[model samples]
Target: MNTKNEGVISEIERYAIKDGPGIRTVVFLKGCPLKCRWCANPETQKSIYQLMYWPNRCIACKQCILECPNNALSWGNPGIQICRADCASCGACTQICNSQALTMAGQHKTADEIMQIILKDLPYYQTSGGGVTFSGGEAASQGEFLCKLAKECKKHRISTCIETCGYAKWEIFCELLPYIDYFFYDLKIIDEKDHMTYTGVSNKLILDNFSRLIQAKADVTVRIPVIPGINNTQKNVEQTIRFLLEQAPGCPVSLLPYHRLGASKYDKLDMEYTLAELAPPSEKEMFQLKEQFVSFGFPVRIGE
Candidate 1:
């Protein structure tokens, strides 16, 4: 846990309550092994700094085009042309542009530096029984940095929580258990074939890692995103519940009803939204699914 160790981060969000119990500051780490189509923070998937363009915000301002040192940007009809291959993400254009038509994602920070920023909200955490949550694009992928930073929090007696995709090497996940107090584990699908089709990776490792967590008796809470056209069906819900009961009986589950809140992020990153027209599950559907999990004797929470 060296203070000098640094990591690529997307954002340090403050006063987030839903990440864990009480008030929390969520540190969003960059990079992921899975490419879930419904990912809200598409910006966090890549560790590298990226330029984001918003066409609507462009007032045909040639500032970005003229200021780009590498000639990577050009004026296109009403939108800005971005030669991503040539662009360096140096923020030169973002600095000169006034409308915020362009943005950048990812920032580099050391464990010591980040804690200084997080410590500003220490009073809120202390009074509200809140602490810090390390989330991702899969915090496990950045094992060395995550562990070091979490240990620093431990040194200060601050509770630590992690939101993970459970897709990393078991060794990495195992080593992190000691530093993390609570885990928000995502279990998107039980079937390997469907899982790969949707998330661009197999769920075998995720399931295996979760099994170990249960066996280890770690404080884990399972989160399942209720994607309307994907895993929200009755068949998938029952299958998921059966698997959870078998591995960790009476384990708490939280059903995160899908929302289009991150849809704009995809637009910002110039990526296609696969679930573009698909709607989130209705309140009735979410409750019915909750009841189904409860019927199997597993404690359930909705949209938490």
Candidate 2:
């Protein structure tokens, strides 16, 4: 497959309302540059295919162990065991698993293949004033494929939104500018050190890109994941408010209270969730945060 024409993705969700202006289709492209500690979509973090196993779904059929070409599966005390090192994520075992215990997270698809799915939702998009949203682990991480898909969407007069972390090159953002109608950009932490500690990357590039977007008059909604014990502190919020006040005054802000919805996914993928004990911010907390933004003359909304 031509790399520029193909993209690895987790799923194509139809009828998504919160992601964009109206009822929409959300294309979850796989791959990311930053490893945000509080990322809700762990499966999309890696570009390659990942094997997911559910113990409850396993019937002890041992079908997977027998099907493994890499000898990566075996029986353990409670259930089947996977040697991730040996496993190539070829998905042979998942294909043969009758009990639906095993599955692969990533799918390699051509832009045309994805456009077919998007076109199917045309009636809904037209009536609801919704369009396709290119979301991801980070849509910009798959630059070429994302540009191709967004270009195709525009050709069909489909309004497009990109939900991004703002960590990619400015050139990629430039490529996407003409095709994207709106951008849901994340502004997780204001302090550069804190940002690095939590998201495994410096915020310099992110902030720089955001500033450029603001200067360019791009329609962007800044999203902050209100994770407890992270960026929820008064000091951090103040810094965030100040930065936005300086660079992106009046830009709409979306306060997304952090949730543990994807925590269980860690276990399925055999990955550790460091914030397992952390709880989501309360309604009162969200309101207070919203008030901070609103008080500064910035439009704010909680949740999506």
Candidate 3:
């Protein structure tokens, strides 16, 4: 039944408990508005197809060198290297790599195609109070496709949720609210200057959208990533608490401590890991930070 509403996604993780209530399947969509230094899923940030090279899996085979249409791949001093400027990401090299050393990150899928997959876990979702969660690079960025997929989920009586940066237009959210039951909204940086400095985006749109979503009474949870030497500051946390109180009084908050879980991903993508040395907060610190929000009469936890 492949309803052919094409969309690009990085991966689909099933039986994910952290995405939402009970057991859930998370569809990791591609592309995002924010460029946070400590991004856990850097591969999802790009809209186009990109390559992830796992050097450990390389068998020293030069098959990719022969398959490359642009001759973009060549043997470097250490190993095979891809010329950033010449590589077209046509997946020729990826296809020829029998060892699965190189693979494309984004996969093109249709809503109907995805629905068939979602149906496979319907029993687990129904029994465990869980369903499909549309996570992103910011799901609202692909509003039309999101709406279509969400509609399909709802039509099947499947619970749908979204994890967004809250940086898109109000119309997009409005279009999705009817179908999406839960929203895992991220509130990374509170201060305008700090937000722009770290994520390369203003906090205004995000704040306004949060306010709108709260006012609309949509099922939204504020998820904060406590990055060390960044937004975890006492002042910023207090400011964030204040903002939350104003926009979404008593809303549930989840504090996700920054970790190096995605550090290796940067190297695979041929990018630098800026926060390589930044460590996650200790249990005590995480709880102390959680108390900041809890004190404001909001139900808060250390992790989502």
Candidate 4:
């Protein structure tokens, strides 16, 4: 049997609404291959710890620059200049920053350490019918660790679930399916070219995996993040509904409207915001998508 020290996790959030049934303890694993233009969790994109700075928190103290051991932090006319290439994310600057302007993204914790934190909320899980949900940066990307953690959760009679992009190997997904009671699967653009254009990867693997999950009869809830001017069109919604109907006929789908919630994070990471001008879909647009899915006789909800 594999030990619990194998898997590395970043954060464990309890009482999450959008992950699964009732309340949930969402385990956020770091690392992702896709670079979606409007990703809400940009920090999870990288596999290692990264420095993040908030301009609003800076009091012009310049303490971070002096404390930075790698000389990566420098004061500029505008604010501070952090050399990404030179900075190793040692968190020395983050620790000394009295204004809390600088912060670090990832931290390492074993599966046992994670499970201990999760079990603390067992009472809430029991009353709410919620369980542990392993989310990503693509949980299947770290399949070996996830599989072991799922088994451990099962041994303790704790319900388990996984929220995935479905861009993973079939064998790895299959191994974890039995351990997962419910799957919050994401279905973005149906067109291969459009999918690759927006999310940096082809939808072939995702579609194939969805089909496999249906064949294996896994309990799944398909989630669609409805972004305006991107996938909020009638054509896209129709195509998505058709695909879901043919693949997982009666499975419920949730339409998640896009928001500018992650826009601030892009600035903190010093990354350009591609969808800065793009606004979220209107309530009418979201209702239109819901109506289209309802016409197909499939159970649908507006949000989590």
Candidate 5:
């Protein structure tokens, strides 16, 4: 109930195997510093709560429109239309919708409240050598809240991991280093200009933090999402290999092939996806890239 210790989160995925070493629970924190064009989890980009309306689930009930105090809901061509600008995400309509066509995407929960959910999977973590993974829009965006949760996990002797973009201040990573057992850090674009062009942020900080992490000997796996016509070229891949060879030699790499799996999420959130037409790279391309990195003596894998 203490707002000061609370953080906004998109959702939590239990029994996740890819996030960390073992069977892990991934806590998806809300908010991000980057706006990558191919971001799959569009719902987690914003820092606040959002409404997700699934028209197919609507039963033509006008109760949502009637209960909406802000007049944000209105009957439209197919079902209920939400005026996002005027909607406050109050959850009033969601509470009254019996069909469950509408739902909120984020939740405000204190670190202790989240720890309760995490502890439920303690048995799995213990048996499988997995623990909890603090994933995000970028977990470092919620530094204080993340540190608090990590602290609690440590108290319970639960191994912890963090999946991050390495965009936040170095101080935040320092705070998490003591508690985090592993890290899944993203290195989207090696070039600063291209990084800013695609993700709306410079890669200087990301690179700097990554170097620092390597120097500090943090257990990290650098992940690269191979987007076609973007960072999938030989030049970018060479640059990435060179950088990793210099900064994180012999580090493990995970190549995440681009996919349109989350394209429908944009429609549900009523947002535009700039890369809707972009196609995922072929398996051959991913394997080639992996081989390239592997040739450099860096351990590489195809998927996350």
Candidate 6:
């Protein structure tokens, strides 16, 4: 088992739907290894904590530039350039900026400290059959912290779930399986080469760990993000159906059509939105995909 202590989480989102079986408190951990082009939560991409700056919100008063000790903040026509690599997340610029443009992404908290916040919604959990879900920026990237938190949730008799890309080692998944009641595993593309082309890593480890989970009879749900012109083709869908039938016939599949909801977040993070012009799949396209999955006798959900 990997015993390294990763950084603690940044935020806990309570009463979340579409994450698991019931109403869930999603603990948003702050690190990931992959540089997925369509990543919704771009702020969580980095391994370390970061502060996001909104260019529109800035009044161009140069308050932030003056306050930054490292000279990381500079004013250009594009607004402020807070050098992410050089600037420490000291919040000095964020404090001086009155427009609420500069904001931090992560916070350090102990497992017990987080649990206290989670348990407050225990009544909702009991009523709605929801407990807690550890989501990312790939939760498995912070395996030790996730494992410890999962154990604590189980000790409280809270049904637990994890939304992961399954990109970590099998040992990491093995250590986590005991505490997780449901696994929301993302299977974006079946073809390893295609997967790597978009998600910046091979799907070999993901596929291997998923097969291991199936052998262990873990409760798993497969998710596919139906990005138009990407994985939404008939061939990709057929390949996915074939893989699922052979590997995990019992697992329910959800087809999540891509959206531009996170496009603005890219601006806030000062990162490029690669699929800026790409529109989400049409309703007709979504239903077509759903029908394809249904043809294989696989239960399908259109979104989430």
- Among these predicted structures, which one has the highest TM-score? 2
lDDT of 5: 0.92
Every candidate's lDDT: 0.89, 0.93, 0.89, 0.85, 0.92, 0.85
The C-alpha stretches of model 6 lying farther than 4 A from their native spots are 2-6
lDDT tens readout by residue for model 3, 1-304: 1233889998988999989998998998899989999998999998889988889889998999999999989997657898878988899899899999999999999887788888999999999999999988887777788888998999999999999999998888988888999999999888899999999899899999898888888999999988988988988988998888888889999999888888998988898888888888889999888877788899987877
Please give the distance, in angstroms, between residue 229's alpha carbon in candidate 5 and its true position after superposition. 1.1
TM-score for every candidate vs. truth?
A: 0.96, 0.98, 0.97, 0.96, 0.97, 0.95
Candidate 5 lDDT over residue span 9-102, tens digit each: 9998998998888999899999999999898998999999999999889899689999999999999887888999999999999999999999
Model 1 C-alpha lDDT per residue in residues 160-242, reported as the tens digit of each score: 99999999988877877888899899999888999999999999999999999989889999999999868986678878988
RMSD of each: 1.5, 1.5, 2.0, 1.5, 1.9, 1.6
Model 1 scores worst on lDDT over the 10 consecutive residues at 1-10
TM-score of 4: 0.96
What's the lDDT for candidate 6? 0.85
Q: For candidate 3, report its TM-score.
A: 0.97
Q: Flag the better candidate by TM-score, 2 or 3.
A: 2
Best by lDDT: 2
lDDT of 2: 0.93
Q: The CA-based lDDT of model 4 is what?
A: 0.85
Give candidate 3 regions above 4 Å deviation: 1-4
Query: Between the candidate structures 1 and 5, which one is better when assessed by TM-score?
Result: 5
Pick by lDDT: 3 or 5, better one: 5
Which residue pairs show collisions in model 3? none
